[model samples]
Target: MTPKRVLVAYGTKHGATAGIAEQIGTSLREDGLDAVVLPADDVDDVRDYDAVVLGGALYAGHWSRKAKRCAERNADSLKHRPVYLFSSGPLDSSAEQQDVPPVPAVAQQMERLGAREHATFGGSVTAQTPGLMARVLVRSGKAGDFRNPERIQSWAHHISAELATLP
Candidate 1:
């Protein structure tokens, strides 16, 4: 059988979410799946694919608007196939609380578009580029890079296996 076609689309502000999406696409390809990574705003259609992975960056307890738009726009087509949603957020290292808020409305909407799984991953925060108030928050030790490559890799493996097994 031909490899399953998967669309891995994402939104990012600092580029971290984009990196995560690329990693997932790479893993899927390594598993012999036909995966394409594109910015959420750039993906025109989902009807041609067998599976779709929608991702976004979380800010102030909300998923990126662009990601939500992509999913919403393709909802009808996506619902006919397997769908997954992911978020890159949280500056907390401890998985116990992760200092992350619940999945935002935008992400929830994406899941409504036939998502089979939704995963939230820790992300990075930069002090040098922060605004005045954000810089103060960072200087006060309230910010840090909480991203764990191992955790990301594990999720990628799971998705890769699932996509590879699709007929």
Candidate 2:
């Protein structure tokens, strides 16, 4: 029996969302699935994978353009597969504390694709993050890396378990 192929694609600014996608891919692989992680811009098609986990970084309460465009471009194919959506943002612990519903755009995408679940993960912003706003936030002590590895792994494992039950 062949292992199921899963694609973990992300749209990120300053690489935080990519890191989350990589974590999801690793967890999926550990569960004995064939998972590949890629940048959203590079994913031209979803026809090759049995399932997909698509994620984006949030900016001003909006999903990244790259991520949104990827979903729009592959809407037809994605709708036919098991799909999960995620957003990486909230420089604070809000995401870990409670369910942060998807932004309006992401919600629309989730409905359009019939996604099984959506997770909102904490984001990162530090002095090293290039941007005047990031620097300002860092100076104000309002930015930090809030991504919880345990939560990410747990969600990925949940997806893995769900996929196991699928054809």
Candidate 3:
């Protein structure tokens, strides 16, 4: 019996989304699956994995361009596999209030690729970041660390359970 291979691919600007992807990969591995975490741009083939979890940081209500392109380029292979999409953005505790909405174009692309699930998770913003805009956003009280590790773990657990039931 071979362990299921899962790919957790992500796109990040300040590394927040990458951290989330690593956590997901860790959780999946703990659940008895083989998981690899990689940058979305680094993955050129989805045919090597049994399942995929694609995520990206959302900026201005849009997923990272790299993630969008990854999906578009691998749509054909991804459609035949179990794929999940996640967006990490919004420095608010309330998921509903976050600016994590999937870009319309990206959402349509994911749908065409047959993604099974999509989730929006809270993100982090730091005041010491190099970008002036990021620093300003943090100083203006619109950004802070709102990531919920427990929630991320729970979602990963759910995915693990679902994968376990797959034929």
Off by over 4 Å in 2: none
Could you tell which candidate, 2 or 3, scores higher by lDDT? 2
On lDDT, the candidate that comes out on top is 2
Model 3, range 1-167, lDDT digits (tens) per residue? 98899999998888889989999999999999999999999999999999999998888788888888888878889999999999888778776554455668668867798888888888888875558878888779897877788888889999999999998
Error of 3 at 12 (Å): 0.8
Tell me each candidate's TM-score: 0.86, 0.99, 0.93
lDDT of model 3 at position 151: 83
Per-residue lDDT for 1-167 in model 1, tens only? 78888899998867778888888888788778899999999987988888998889888778988888898888888888988888887767553244344375854675577577787888777685456745776888877776677777777779878766666
lDDT of 2 at 114: 99
Evaluation by lDDT, superior candidate among 1 and 2: 2
Worst 10 residues of 3 by lDDT: 94-103
Task: Give the Cα-based TM-score of candidate 1 against the true structure.
Answer: 0.86
Question: What TM-score quantifies how close candidate 3 is to the native fold?
Answer: 0.93
Model 1, position 163: C-alpha lDDT score:
64
Question: How many pairs collide in each candidate, listed in order?
Answer: 0, 0, 0
